[model samples]
Target: MPDERTHARAQIRGVKETAEADLLAKKNVIGVDIADKVTDGKNTGQLSIVVFVEDKQPTSKLSAADRVPKEIDGVPTDVQQMTVELQGPSMQLVDDVTPQVDTTTYAVLHGGISMGPLRSVYLTPPDVTSAGYYIFAGTLGAMVRDRGNGATMALTNFHVACVNSTWSVGDRMVQPSLLDGGSSSNQFGSLTRATLSDDVDGSVVTVDTGRSTTPSVQDIGDVAGHTAATVGAAVRKRGRTTELTYGTVISTDFTVTINYGSDVGSRTLHHQIRVQTDTSRSARFSDHGDSGSVVMDNNRMVVGLLFAGSSDGQWTFANPIQSVLDELNVDLMVAPVVTRPIVSCLNTRLVVCNITRPVACLFTRSAGCNLTRTASCLVTRAVACNVTRATWCPVVTRTAVTCSVFTRAGCDIPIPDPGPIEGGQSEDGHGYGATADVPEEYWAGYLAALEEINELDGPDEA
Candidate 1:
């Protein structure tokens, strides 16, 4: 059964489909879509068909035919004023000013870094032909694997990678971008696929051999996978100019018209995800040069491919990640998830054991090493413990077992006095002292084991 949000979204989509053409034809209207209803600049927790306009005006100043209705097919209509444009640098005349350079270089290419066509066309703007040219670049959104050949590729917006309609396959792609001081020597890949449609504005570049690429996003870690964008969900992006920023999914299944300059002209995109800056974490979600950044949820799952935004940077738009992936026929190149084995012990005094080698247990006296039988043990010690696999020890009583003169057959090792176990006392006055002093690498496992022991064993007792 569809939940409340899903049902509401379906209803809004229906109303939008029926009313979109008519709404776009209205005066000052730039786009239309479904979004959370806003009243007096605050969201009202209600879904509505949003009418995007270049400027908001009072009904008294508008003609009756141009005025937007309050409701469409029983759904509320929200008239929002914002100027939306493709979030990429268009052809512009650069006289003598030096472009700001991003000096960071990546040996292994990944997402969330500057990239673009190997060379931006040097165009002579009409009437001014004094050595002026256009240098363009945008964020490399992600790394993907081609479905047909399993070859690695870099993902970015078509406008960022293609530059113009004259672009062809095998065109060289560069890192850091020409605008960011990247030269022809910095070429890393070549454009293999691209699409500019109502659903996506994405492209993929075949990464060159000998050049390594990871699935991780800069500053955001690895992307586990991709998921559908959910309204009101928190999302983030690491882009070329913005680096890392937070936002909220204010709307989905959005249809917006963006001007891609003269090269591509104005194209209307459908089924886009609209995001608004999460003011608590950032003032803006994206900006020029941030195009092609992948928007991911809190769990680091890709949700959208950022492509467009408002001129003021408050509102941003993205193509759903699934749409982009489908269009390119590629899958996200993600790292495998690693699961660690759990180590547990019963006695109050924690024992550091090297499971990889022969059974050799070392006991040390340190605070915070309280763990019970059946509880996972992870403790920090000065000495490193080689624990590749989990080892289970039988439940033992709380008796002081000194290791001053202890030895085991076939195991020749020196025994150090762990001193007296102290501090862990019960009401019965009979309890064992918990020892801490595990290697730093194993500290996380030990802490988890201690928590489990405390929960299962409750209070320390004789």
Candidate 2:
């Protein structure tokens, strides 16, 4: 009586149950998940199971690829590389040299919602009293609505919301964090779910009905929508520490082990989007208090939830948006559309000065505006560029030469010609134009675009 999709899912579950122990016992194999097969950027519409394998390089003599099986219980299986460490609940120490923000100032600027990145703090008795309270701060990822009941919830990292998995359900989470002068009055939500697994390192807090909250991310504006991330997509985020920062997707499906200090040791996270810092901005994309910040693509769609970063802040990681939505059983609140102010350029064409926030321009391939090169757009007497929402370029080229910030780190001033510019400009809330070395900052994003373009052109061009 079940549809093929449902039947395949069920069969895959059975295969996992039967082979989980043996499969996990194999080298590098840690976990399993079910998903549809994607071929040539299109979903095959056929269900398949995913097997998780760990380590920097997944390979083995016992099995074909690290002992991973191509099929389980007659269902096709795919392997995902991940990192596993032995980290427990503990606050990450903030480095003095790392770029930091003043919590009190930003909290006052945003209002209602307590916002800041890192500081010292407490979690109270049951969660942890040994060190009094754990001192930590992470970005409040976003406000999500439960799929079943439509109840609003606060999304953040397990380390941010659950005290590194120490806190249980019903435990209160405070904003400005305890270390930033947060107390009972600032309690925003209670832990409803926590996941420290192969798929995610996150938790959801059921926000108290009485508290003031919005589905909007500070500085960057509203959550226009949600989408899965692809390598090379230009993304941005507003966090407690950095306020607003930008970066490029280096790898969408990546795995790495994280060292969570001595007591917590380390833990492996699977299916993560690895992002490198925008060289044009501060060298680091995020700092101590950035964990739990929700990353949005150029089109303002939720892409992933930030969790960890390297000491230098150059490298950062996140759980894919789809995985978070599924695991939490929640949906992002879609921001409403609003008309934006337009400016007339040289009295010949009307140009939308700021189409990146609050309202998105939907004119793709409209009259006089059909430039859709990777991360770049051009329009004359038009509403929007022909570029897709997932595009890395947000720049709009016009005869008037007024350039707006694109979503990717490499996006910069509009060039007269349509040939792809070497690199993008930097967006750190500063009006920086593209430099000759812009490509260096956006090498990762540009490389991905080049690969795609090369594939389209075929073997001769390659």
lDDT of the candidates, in the order given: 0.76, 0.58
TM-score, one value per model? 0.74, 0.50
The TM-score obtained by model 1 is: 0.74
Top candidate on lDDT is: 1
Global Cα RMSD, each model: 11.9, 22.4
- Across 384-415, the per-residue lDDT of candidate 2 in tens digits comes to 32332222323444333333333334444343
- lDDT of the structure predicted as candidate 1: 0.76
lDDT of 1 by residue, 72-121 (tens): 87999999998987787433344442444344668889989988786656
Q: Which TM-score value belongs to model 2?
A: 0.50
What alpha-carbon RMSD in Å does predicted model 1 have with respect to the real structure? 11.9
Question: Could you tell me which 10 consecutive residues in candidate 2 have the lowest summed lDDT?
Answer: 354-363
